[model samples]
Target: MIPQGPGEEDYGALSEQRKLVLATYDLCAVCALPFRDELRWQVTFDDQLQQMGETFAFNEAPVHEVCALYAAQVCPFVSSPHARLGDAQRKGQRRAETLTLAGFTHTATVFGHDSELQVGESILMFEMADLRRIHRLTGADDARSAYEAVLRDEARIELDDAERRVVDLLCAPTPKGEDSGPVMAGAAWFIGAVFCPQIRRVQAMKKFADAEGDLYFQLAANFLDNPEMMAEWEDSNDASTAAAMSWFRTRQSVPAVLQQWRADGARRVRDVRGRRPRAVGAAVVVPRDEAAIRRRRDAEAALRKARRRKR
Candidate 1:
């Protein structure tokens, strides 16, 4: 490698080839330590860990084993047979200690605290490649963390706004007698079951049907999860899940909410036409002209004749 002049020091930055060589050596040095405190060291595995490079202190068998395991955990790729080369060429290879330090620094930037493992109680360092290895060993850490967070009251508070938004969206008047099951399932119900309950609580207080003229169908669906609750709600009859959730305030009260949503939909359809006109031309209007009138009259007459024939 050409040494850089004092004026152009940055120009001699390590090439990709040099970087790889350094990284491999770094992996080897870390593999030299016996990271496992009490575990027996297998001779073959220890040799494999070093990739048959220079051995560490003769008396430090345990230390060597620990180092080897830590190296393996950090970078298994370097120990591969394909990469190990002849002794004559390897003599001038980069120092493993320097490379290991660089690799350790790199890992700290990439994996953060989550990538840290129990190498020793006192030494809490993260391996750059350990993030991928850890995830592969178990499952995604983020998924597990999110699940844990979901069960917390703080999680409910965090999702409360989004939950309210979903409920509000779901409550908007849809087609009369339309099954709100799928909608509710996707919206408020899904939020509570998959996310948090505080969101449902926030939504329950908002008047949907009376003030907004929309029913809290989604909020109601969340409560209907329990069979016993569904039964009680049916026996007592309620307005919506939001109402039932508020009134009952426990897991048992959900059924009443489901019953209310069911009844509210039925009553709304019977009491009001369940449909309001779109402002004049906001929707396509089929004009009641002569042709349309004739078609309508013919259809009515045909229905009447069919009924008479059936009778």
Candidate 2:
């Protein structure tokens, strides 16, 4: 039996009407973009249908018309910068196959952004990386074990309550074309990201700063000496300042800090002189708008003083 949306306590007890009401959300058509033509799914099940008695407990009553209720679409896939390009190229090179529910073989792709499942004999090891492909496999016990194995192995990120609720809603089984219900897709998306790996988010952030290298160190040094430059950002209302703040949220650090560090002639601990100098020269790189920073600082100081006086 097919599972309903993520929340049902027992899918098997649902009436036919309830079962028909569940919505299905497929990977394709998620964006609601118009396509030139419709796509179809092909399905085939195990030829040797043997029943293994007393070995399995069904979570949801089996549904015979699962394929008729669902369809799959293929979309263009991309890779993160942290990911090896060669691996992406190889995946792209592989012949894309169709997804069929009834088919003897199952076809799917794994992505850093998507949820993952581990497969194979290390039953319960839960980290198997290989994707299983088979021609003939059957039995309630076998199928239940396989599905349970997949769910048990599925890796998900922890999310706050609000975010997790949204994810739960998205995972709900819905009918075709009704997958994304009343909630704006954006909300659903934010929730999905909470439980998802966020591979792209990481890759995008890494691009803004030099991570894992000496360049980052050099930048950090620049910020240490010119601390005022970094602090000035808090007061500036300029578009550039706003842009900088936006970038920092994703990258999680201020570029001005690094700039100041470099200006102060800061160097790695190992590079320090045997006898440390009592003081170091400041190497400030002033842009044409240098005065704005100083003005912002003064303004803030005056504001604080005025607030204290009023109190």
Candidate 3:
């Protein structure tokens, strides 16, 4: 079933409850299915992107990469250049000439006060480190081009020397009866880079643990005991590993780690050649000022009036 709003299924407005479920479990908003190992995609307008500047949080839940492209090709408001964002909440807002389909590994759920000053609805926010692709589109043709580009990129993934070294370290067998701190650190990097989708963080961890056996658990315990080891991991050259450590430090137990991982997957690493480590997992609240609150209230009032007039 589609996400239900106040009265019925509203494709324009996502229910707050559904948003929570999607963010908490890392499910695709369109299909309501687990994301597993796939990259998460968010649709953004040029105006919205410009308004938010370099960093922005999305109120809408993320969709699968393919799902986002499919929606862009089929949804009238999204596919048509002449269409505008005509929902009651955002009336008269013209759609931007350029739409961006951003792919990322995971998103953090930001909770804060809404216009009414209550526990505000949760929204997904992510840092640049988590981003993998930023494909821009102007029409259905661009969606098809992007889909093709995705396939080409996936088929031709080429690891650089450093990345290859990291992979080799992760795949190397640990010496029997020895500590696995170094290898586990590499595992963290690999997981952050490769399989740490928001919907399957715990499953990935479980898989690695099962394969590595007692060594994995022992290293996890060591991190819990030393805690400082996590700090040392922050010094890792891999931007993704450093970001992952930021969230990992907060979780000390298996359950806590699993819950947080399911809530927000570790930040994926970006290319290291020209990139610097960026902060990750920070939460951003919506309607930061009084003007924004007033605008939201007016929108709701307008929507109610419109509904009554239609009836």
Which candidate has the highest lDDT of all? 3
Q: In what order do the candidates fall by TM-score, top score first?
A: 3, 2, 1
**TM-scores, in order shown?**
0.14, 0.19, 0.41
Least well predicted 10-residue stretch by lDDT in candidate 1: 103-112
Q: Residue 297 of candidate 2: its Cα lDDT?
A: 47
Q: Which consecutive 10 residues in model 2 have the weakest lDDT in total?
A: 120-129
For each candidate, what is the lDDT? 0.27, 0.27, 0.47
Candidate 1 — what's its lDDT? 0.27
- Model 3 residue 3 lDDT? 61
* Candidate 2 local lDDT, 1-311, one digit each (tens): 98667745222223211211111111212322111112211223232112323222111112212222221211111112123336555755532232223221111211122212222101100111122233222233333344455446544434333222223333343334333232222221111111112212322212223344534333333333333343444333532232222222222222222222222333332255333323222222334355764664464455446545756
lDDT of 2: 0.27
Residues 1-311, candidate 3: write the lDDT tens digits.
96645734232122443443344334567755545557778888776655766565675768878778877778565467675566797786655677788887766433322323223322223332267877788887888777676556543334433233323223233335322223343445232212223322221223443545445444434443344565555445543354345434443222222345422332221232234323332221222345543553454355446545756
The number of residue pairs in model 1 that clash at the backbone is 20
Show model 2 residue runs off by greater than 4 Å: 1-136, 148-157, 160-162, 168-180, 186-311
